[model samples]
Target chain A: MDILGDLLLGVQTAFSFWNLTYCLLGVFLGTAIGVLPGLGPTATVAMLLPVTFGLSPETAIIMLAGIFYGAQYGGSTTAILVNLPGESSSVVTAIDGYQMARQGQAGKALATAAIGSFIAGSIATVLIAFFAPLLSSVALAFGPHEYFALMVLGLAASVVLASGSLLHAVGMILFGLILGLIGTDVQTGAMRFTFGSFELADGISFVVVAMGVFGLGEILSNLENESDRTTVLTKVTGLMPTRADLRAMLAPVGRGTALGSVLGILPGGGAMLSSFASYALEKKVSKNPQQFGKGALAGVAGPEAANNAGAQTSFIPMLTLGIPSNPVMALMIGALIMQGIQPGPSVVQDQPVLFWGLIVSMWIGNLMLLVLNLPLIGIWVKMISIPYGYLFPCIVAFCLIGVFSLANSTFDIWLMGLFGVAGYILRKLDCEPAPLLLGFVLGPMLEEHLRRAMLVSRGDVTSFVTSPISAVLLLVAAALIASVLAPAIRSKREEAFQDED
Target chain B: MQGHRTKDFWAGAIYLVLGLATVILARDLTLGSAARMGPGYFPTVLGGLLAIIGLVSLLRGLLRPGELVERIHMKPMILVIGATLFFAIALDFLGLAVALPAAMFITATASKRFRLAPVPLLGLVAFTIFCVLVFVRGLDVPLPMFGTLFGG
Candidate 1:
């Protein structure tokens, strides 16, 4: 009953002129960035963070959240039209999406992706609307010890779940923790790792690191692979899926939503994991599993659905508990703080309209994405004809502009440049940047909680295990880490890490 | 494949050195005791972890058996790195007013397929102004801009 009233209030707020306008703008820009390769929603949101400084908190979040989902949807378009994926999550979509395009079913593949995303996004929003308050209350039970444990678990999971060697992941995480330690000591008024520079007093900007890894690093990588720019000459036809296609897709869509909604709540690349997991699951369950990689519609639909759903629902932990499930969500938490809103149980009570409005606008934004993407497919497909030479320079230009706009600091731009070089080197070395990013974003939060918990416990280390919630979270993290390291679990992990030939 | 292990080993060694440097740097900072858990606590722990991980990476590189895939193009990678370094140095002195548009134009020129056009140059200039006005002037952000005309 309370959920219904809150949802109603949410709808009322979402329907307002200002909220609606930003929602539209967010989806539009989200789709635009999604269509363009290299820029993901995180960088786009980071770029626009300053622009939204003047708006109300609810309005800003609504638009930013919309951009996130919209980018997920838009990302698939490029994956289908070209083999390029805007992010790792869309990599699976590219597998069969581009294949379907090769078979002259680009329209159907795109339509399925859009519709599946809409259904999945809407369902995820509803789940969040109903489930968030309950989740918020549960989070309210957490003391500092629990938060510290949870953060530790988050960092551990991020390292364990990251693609590549666990050793490298752990190294990256430690590096991130070090980077997070650059600013003045909140506890002792001491500055560490500043190297006597004034900029070091505040630590490295999240925008700088984010832009370096996602924006500049991607551009550098893209520039390297300039030869893979050939577009298929296949014609797109059939805007809607056939009846048989729909029947076959329905079950996969449901499975995807179910998989995504759960995985999205976990820290790490939960959405990306779920999307790939859904595709793999669909193939395993299908009677015709052999048809898995050969341009199957279910392949495109299931993962697309899962990706969007996970992207939307990941906000649950971030909003209700101030626990970010991913780097992007962590950025959103930062944005929330910048807006002077403390995210937690009190948020629901203090700013019901903001919370509900953001939730309701998600559904509206999903609808808007569908309507906007369908027509824009033709436009975006045409955009693919723009030469990489012409296109890439523009992307690089925007990246520089965005990085500079973040704090209007030349130092940050230099910081971004440094990271970009570092990221490129890492990429060359086959070390993934995602784990490093996860580490950088979560490092400061984890430190704060760890210190707070220790302080509250009067420097007793046992306090983390004394609390039930913290104990369980820590145990789960331990189990996950143990599973990765144990000889018995090593074989299964090797299989898990296999490229699925 | 055999030689790449040597590369990885060297890389790990360098990271260890960097981590050690950070530790040395952090030692100068005054971190309070257990009750406060100052900034130095985080970095010192991180530095220790990094050094350990670096050693682990070095060991793994030495032990790995499989043939390494050679996907890295050294020339382009160097070029990209060089360009980024150039941007960092150029951004402040050139004042973004002249620097950004020129850098973008140069990047376009570097791509080989796209020649420099007046349109992109003009667009970047316009964007630079918009960014300065909105982010710096309007928002009061301390960006490094030579604003004799805009009253910096």
Candidate 2:
């Protein structure tokens, strides 16, 4: 079917009473959490995953997708108002956004972010509708060798792009892969790492690990330093941007959307990278670069647009190729698998409603966020002031109940607690859990492909390089690693991520 | 000795131990050839790579200046994990009615500003009711409102 026909079908599905309600709820909850400092979409989604089990796949995904992009919109609200980024992707937005708020242009800044995000989201949604099918069709042609190579590229790129020590990131990936090995082997029916636990015979649930690490772990970290949050603007005055502001923001929004859409498609690149890159780009191309850190509308416009766009487009890989570009997408893929749907090239054909409805709902979710963020900005500003003391307990309650609901087993809860401690320690050690999550999700698939490819080639290791596509992919992975290892590029990479620290 | 204090040194040490453990544990599994890769093939290879990476990071930590591991705060970390474990142990015995509030109460103590204020007390009560209503009544998650010990 044509994109228009598909989108129309999606509209029909998304506009259903339940879907629409869940979409609204998803975005609403997303914005609420996004406006709250220290709570992120990853943990929120992980905590909420089990709740979606009772819903239809399309509805479930639409709601989850809403939370993802809706976060980008809500993140900018806190960034602008409180000077604290509610989400990591909004870190750059705070640089100029908070400045604008302090200058009594909080309304204008908020409005710019909303408008920019909506436009970028709309454009990216269209790009997904246009491109996802093409990519899926291409991926359908991949053999075991190609898949193995592709996963290697994905893992390699994720490690390289992730901020922190390269060795640590790689180690985390291997650790995750090892963790993924702890279950009965599919081919042989032999247990690999269950350690005689019957509960682990089926393998660790993704929700359990995610909730423990991102959810409980984050709460532990947040509690470590409970700093008081000070909201700068009590009241926002101008709700609309002036024509001059609009003109200044237009080019940046367009450029940011373009950059974000491209970057979001790359493995390990998503909202965070896109926003940072857009901020850097805006500073470079600006006629008055000095105004960047001091209330440049372009800085607010660019990163907000980029982040939303990146968040939207990052779904392309997960939707088409079954490869997650980031942790949120990894969770989504896990959700799909739990729904008894294998996420890959065939998903586009087999689950058009899910694929298309999710795409269409993103646009609707963006619209919801724009309206929700602009008029209801006061509520969010108030929400940030809500004490961590009250919030953490509730978060803990939710996580416990959520994990317990997985099978009504306390064992999972204990496992979650174990990982929570591990996660906290790992963070202290400067090892990112993001790559590890991705690796865990991809591990079984990677091993399967590797083994199949070897068998197909009769143990010929050269088959990987012999296949042109696989060869190119491996070369790309090699180049990425080499670039990160090179002293010149290593320093440059560190500088790019420097602002984050 | 100072190098032993670096975050990388500890992280690398942890990874090394985990990697070596994985390799050692997988020794009993059939290590089939490259043509017909066994269940052990992937883990053994990955385990070895991890060990190598861990060793390199460990050496790097010892040889070069690195960031020191931050002070570990035992209070929040332990309390939060303790609360979850408390909930797990209590759920089957006391049920959600008892377990949820107790867990929330324990978790509340993790924060320095925690106080026995009326607002937080009300919040605890309200949140427990909300969870019971939502998860138990609305979603029917199969968890007992009150557990076996309570004749739920």
lDDT of 1 by residue, A431-475 (tens): 667767667767777788888888888888888788889999999
Q: What is the TM-score of each candidate against the true structure?
A: 0.91, 0.99
Considering summed lDDT, which 10 consecutive residues are worst modelled in model 1 chain A? A227-236
For B91-121, candidate 1 gives per-residue lDDT tens digits of 6666556655566666665564555678766
Give the distance in Å from residue A447's predicted Cα in candidate 1 to where it truly belongs.
2.1
Q: Please report the candidate that would top DockQ against the real structure.
A: 2
What alpha-carbon RMSD in Å does predicted model 1 have with respect to the real structure? Answer: 3.2
Error of 1 at A49 (Å): 2.2
Native RMSD of candidate 2 (Å): 1.1
Candidate 1 residue A246 Cα shift, in angstroms, is: 2.2
Q: Considering only N, C-alpha and C atoms within 3 Å, which residue pairs clash in candidate 1?
A: none
In the range A1-501, model 2's lDDT, one tens digit per residue, is 587888888999999999999999999999988888888899999889999999999999999888888888889988998888989999999999999888899999999999999999999999999999999999999999999999999999998889888999999999998998889999899898888999999999888889889988888888878898888867887987789888888999999999999989888889999999999999999999999999999999999999999999999999999999999999999999999999999999899899888988888898899899988888888888898888888888888888988987889999999999988989989999999899999999999999999999999999999999999999999999999999999999999999999
lDDT of 2: 0.91
**Highest TM-score: which candidate?**
2
